[model samples]
Target: MTSKITLFQHGTGAMIVPGLFDGTIDIQELLTHGDTGIGSGDGLDGESIINNGTPLLIRGDGSVTIADDHFTVPFVNAHFAAYSTINNIQINDFQSLGNYIFKHHQYQNILFSVKLHGQFEWVKTRSVFKQSKPYPSLVATAKSEKRFESQHLSGTVIAYYYPDAFSKFAVGGFHAHFISDDQSIGGHLMNFSGFNGDLGIQKFKKLDLELPIDNADYLNHDFKNDDIEAAINQAERES
Candidate 1:
């Protein structure tokens, strides 16, 4: 059975969200805590894995706060939470991830901003899905706000140039939620694209990415340069 695994680990991570250009692949098989994940054996050392493609999640209600000093030195507090749905499903991968790079865009006028620090967690369960199994949340809880309209820079189409083979991409956690206190509203595209969904109830229907979400606007073009991917990978290894 394909089950969703909740990955949660509270270790001191690098402060700044490092940049992963592309082609940057690191195959480090981590030795997870023997006590965590499904089919528990030893004691719960606080970890677990359900499957390969587990549910990536990120959700919360209220300003999330934490302190960390790792990764990107001087970037302080590695925290973030971005949320969004995909294929009628919401992904929370970044929920437990620390420090995320966020970009904001303007439609009417070509403008942008950026946010660095980020944090996240996942909703334990929705009232309707009460019987649902819980997943490990790297970070949950979103800044208090009504999700009807704009959830930070969410809803707005933030595009990115993924590797050529990307049939589709997913970016969850708060980069999808809009909790970056450092976000400036315009900047560079990050390593990924936040989750896309139909939250707007206009036209009385869910806003699917396949359908038009906004007016004629700036186009987000993907630079299919293998060199870009190669550069990203080279940088990661050297760093």
Candidate 2:
């Protein structure tokens, strides 16, 4: 994978301890080193920019607008990971299906590390937006959809906090691998996939992980249940 991705996975607190392919083995040179072009002058990842009072606004095209209050930060210094789950991913304001499957979602115990490499933002209002200072910027997205021996690309997806919004870092270029046991690269290519999450205030504890969602005990607003057999059946059906 590229530095943009490593940076994002880390910024959003994606699972996997820094250089461990799956939190079990050590991968050398943890991150894709060299001018990642992402830094806040103070040395912090995307989170730090927000922590330092940077305001980010989301546009319809998936790009971000750093509020004025935020310093002119190219990127961040400290690198850290976020801890989150699909339970938090939402869409269209209604989250029945999403809430059920992701709440306390399943977890894969493979830790990994992240490091951002070359990064450059471009301003291009001529074609898309109206264009302005620094023009609308575009990050050079990377690709890494090759499947692996353990095709199980599972783990807790980390996220971040915006003053008025709750979201994960988006660059039109975030990726992870899902290699099959036989190590075949059959995943999507240059897949423009982003975590489908929602913005909400913490209700239960700091984290509301749904280890299992039982539909039988489900309430009007709670589908907190698990049906492994049904899930398998559904997967089979879809296949």
lDDT of each: 0.19, 0.21
Regions more than 4 Å wrong, model 1: 1-59, 67-164, 167-177, 180-239
* 10 residues in a row with least lDDT, candidate 1: 124-133
Best by lDDT: 2
What does candidate 1's lDDT look like per residue over 1-239, in tens digits? 11112122221111001211111111111112111111110111111121122211112222222211111111001111122322332334332122222221112121111122222221111100001112111111111111221122432222211122321121211122222223222111122234333221101011111111221210222234223333323322111
Cand. 2 Cα-lDDT: 0.21
RMSD of every candidate to native, in Å, equals 21.1, 19.7
Error of 1 at 8 (Å): 18
TM-score computed on alpha carbons, candidate 1: 0.18
TM for every model, in the order presented, reads 0.18, 0.19
Per-structure clash totals for the candidates: 51, 44
Task: List, residue by residue over 1-239, the lDDT tens digit for candidate 2.
Answer: 33322322222111100110111111122122212112221111111112112223222232344424333222222122332222344232112323443454331121222211111111111001122222211210111111112222222111221211111221211121111112122121112123243322211112211111222211222212333233322211112
